[model samples]
Target: MISVTEAKQIIRANIRALPSSLVNLADAGNSVLAENIYAAVDIPAFDQSNVDGYAIRFSEKDITLDIDGEITAGSEIIKSLSKKKAIRIFTGAPAPEGADTIVMQENTAAANNTLTINDPALSKGMNLRPRGTDIRKDELALEEGTLLTPAAIGYLAAVGSAKVNIYRPPALTLIITGNELAQPGLPLRTGQVYDSGSFALKSALQLHGIRSPEILHCQDDPHELTLALRHALSESDMVILTGGVSVGEYDFVSQAAENCGVTKLFHRVKQRPGKPLYFGMKDDKPIFGLPGNPSSILTCMYVYVSLALNMYLHKKESLYQPAILKNAYRKTAGLTHFMKGMYNAGYVEILTGQESYRMSSFAKSNCLVILPETETEFKPGYQTQVHLL
Candidate 1:
């Protein structure tokens, strides 16, 4: 059996980032940039006013003069502010020629179209927004590989980019295998349980910004599993299967995938609850056979599948962090273990009853306490790795 780290490396090596496409700025949120975005023109474009005030030359202080003209946004002023004269300007309006300062209307007394400055503390460049002060022409405003947040989208729009090059989201498929499973809302007969792993896995994917996976549920029949595998391989970039992966009589997913041209990379790992995990590839598409147990499925998804998908999308793959255990944890470690735990207030506490099928512990857990392959028990204050859910 392979270690968890080894399994992760193998899984990541098979995936690749999606190709780039041109998308509108409004639709580029949360997507990764594929190209560096340079400013097409200087921000602010020209000298403008930052406040609704009177534009004046710095040399003019005591002279009462006529207002040359009024300048609003998107309009130009043909007249220049001569010595001892001012121009009435609004916010965002271009500063009149030869004007280097603006006295806010609140600081001046005006009557009968005549204005008198009440404050003499105004300095040159006051309330005047210089051209390219916020951003310069030809400057690289957004770098490649930047994740486009809402702020980023607004920035791109400000820089006059209507469309941006972004990496496309990968197409994903979910295949659930098990004959004893029944859909929710159906009356369960004896020896049958409602299939919850499919919904759980799908919802988890949705939380990570993936919402359009092709989901397929197949019974524990070889023919049905083979057919589903074939369909998934052709259309999906990644296929995640739950159940029928363990070494049981009905475990035919692995064999079916291989028969349908999948090259099995690893079929099991040295971990608790998820030891029967499998990963493979078919026609360059990655496939994951997660453990049937609900908790194990979730753990594997967060640890292995999430990393794989990020690597495929050319994103940073370091989401898990090492944390100090708040209390001691007992284990005879040969295989790596990932136990459900709660991380809070700078401490982590492992939940009890980590059995593969029993998901009660996972309900109260928010993290997975990762234990490396070692033969030792951890005491309080011991540092261990944790994968945040």
Candidate 2:
């Protein structure tokens, strides 16, 4: 078995980034940019008022002025400010020519066309939003490969881009395999249990912005599993199968994938609950066979599948952050273990159960306690790596 890092590197190297598509800015949230976004025009476009005030030329003393015209948002004032004069301007109005400063209405006393500058101790350009203050024409406002966040969307809109080039979302499929599994709300036989892994995996994928994954449930029949694998490979860019990866007699997912012309990348990793994890590729489509247990399925998804997707999309890989161990965490030294835990304020507390089948502890976990293979035991206050969920 190879280490988790080695397996991840293999998966990352094999996956290819999806193609780009032109999408509206409103729909580009959480998508990766495919091209450099250049500013079409200067932000603010023109010198405008930053405050609702009188546009005036700053003078040495308090000067009496006549209001020539009024300018509000979206209105044009062709008049200019002359000496000892001002224009009534609202916020976002273009600054009239010859006006060098804006004295807020609170600082000026006005009656009809006459106005008195109560205090003219302001400097020029005091409240003018200069053209290109936020962005300049032809400037690269956003770089290629950037993950578009809400702020990026607003920025793109401000720069007058109605549409942006972003990477297309990958097509995904999920295959759940097990003979002892049944759907929720259905009566279970004497030894059968409800299939919780599929639901959990589906929910996790949804949280990561993946919806509408084609799901296939195959019992412990090799022919049925092979057929499901073939169908998934034909339609999806990536396929994730949960269960039937271990060495048991009934375990046949790996075999089925191989029979369907999938090239196995690796079958096991030096990890605790997810040791039997499998990664493969068939006709350029990535495939993963995750451990059947609920906790194992979710853990492998977060660590392996999520990383592969991010890498394939050309986004930055999420790394395990360093944190201090809140309490002494002990473990064996051979295998690299990803333990469910809660992290806060620079510390992480490992959850009680590390078993693969345990779902209760996994439900309460908000982070993973990363135990390196070299560390046998950890004392309180010891620093460790943590992967936040």
Best by lDDT: 2
Encode model 2's per-residue lDDT on 179-241: one tens digit a residue.
899889999998898899999999978755577899888889889999999998888889999
Clashing pairs for model 2 are none
- Residue pairs of candidate 1 with colliding backbone atoms: none
* Predicted structure 1, TM vs. truth: 0.89
Q: Could you estimate the TM-score for every candidate?
A: 0.89, 0.92
Candidate 1 lDDT, tens digit per residue, 289-356?
99898888988888888887676545776467778898887888688888899988667898888887
Angstrom error of the Cα, residue 299, model 2: value is 0.8
| Top TM-score model | 2
Q: 344 in model 1: Cα distance from truth in Å?
A: 3.5
